[model samples]
Target: MNQNETQWDKLLKIKTTGRDDSHSDQYRYPYEPTSYMVLERLANSGLIRKNNTLLDYGTGKGRVCFYLSYQTRCRAIGIEYDEAIYQKAIANKETAVAGNRSSFILCGAENYEVPVDVDRCYFFNPFSVEIFHTVLAKLYESYYEKPRELLLFFYYPSEDYISSLMTQEQLMFYDEIDTSDLFSGDDNRERIMIFKVI
Candidate 1:
């Protein structure tokens, strides 16, 4: 663990490991925890507020939800497709300071019903392009059902994700947080891509 992870673990009172992968064919991807550095940048962006409700897709161990909820004091909901990972997240949530306002649901992104009050969504390349499309449709439906300003945050977005996201007319590029300085290597593709939909 790095300095940030150690601090975060102490702060949240939970120990989590990154680069966790799964072999289950039903899962779209594995369990890789998002770096705390990227999340710190995202928190500093001020896109999330205390009133905003954030949905973290594929929330591995609920790190993003717990961190953001603690940092921004915003309500958070996490959806994890894997049962074991969901259990782990639940365990962590129990110890987090913002546990009362944070929830972790064990369900695939495709099946999750985007809450009407959810004004923010976080994606960290957790699923396939197909599942992303489905979730996008769900978001669209939820927005239309209860029209409200919403933001999508994608970190280290993949090319396929970019391509699929381009097809959505409602989402507009809002802002970005350049995270190149945080990493040592030149391949620091750490960018917090923000999109807005109203």
Candidate 2:
């Protein structure tokens, strides 16, 4: 953990943990906290604004939601299917500085209804490609119904996710933010990939 993370927790009063595959299955993936460094970069990337509402798919413990809410002052909704994890997020909600700006939903992304006004979505390799596509389809439905601009922010994307996202006709590459130096990974794919609807 970094000093920023310590301060963030101290100021906000929350604790987010890492991967726990023991509770994961086909539809749900393990809970791994996105690196705070990567999140800090995304928060300052200018891809999102205060006017936008961001949806965090599989938002475990609501770290992304609260962080971005603090950083950008934008509204955020975190979705988590795991009951235990969702409840934990709800607990964190009580103390979050951005609690008013951030909320948690206890439902799977594939079934959750995408809010019409949401212009940004986030993922952290949260689920399988099948569930991801389902969530994308719902987003597509919302887009067609309202036809507004939308951006999907993916962090430390996996090959399965990259391949699936690239084939989506509605999304185009907007930008990328590299964070490979933050870790000891050999593959330089340690980056945040931003995609916007075409």
Q: What is the C-alpha RMSD of each candidate to the true structure, in Å?
A: 1.5, 1.4
Looking at model 2, which ten-residue stretch has the lowest summed lDDT? 13-22
* Clash count for each candidate, listed in order shown: 0, 0
- TM-score, model 2 to reference: 0.94
List residue ranges in candidate 1 displaced over 4 A: 24-27
> After aligning candidate 2 to the native by TM-score, how far in Å is the CA of 173 from where it should be?
1.1
Model 1: lDDT of residue 24: 42
In model 2, the Cα lDDT at residue 19 comes to 63
Each prediction's Cα lDDT score?
0.87, 0.87
Error of 1 at 85 (Å): 0.5
Model 1, 6-72: lDDT tens digits are 7887888776667667644543877888888988889988899899999999998998998899899
Candidate 2 — which residues are off by over 4 angstroms? 1-4
lDDT of 1: 0.87
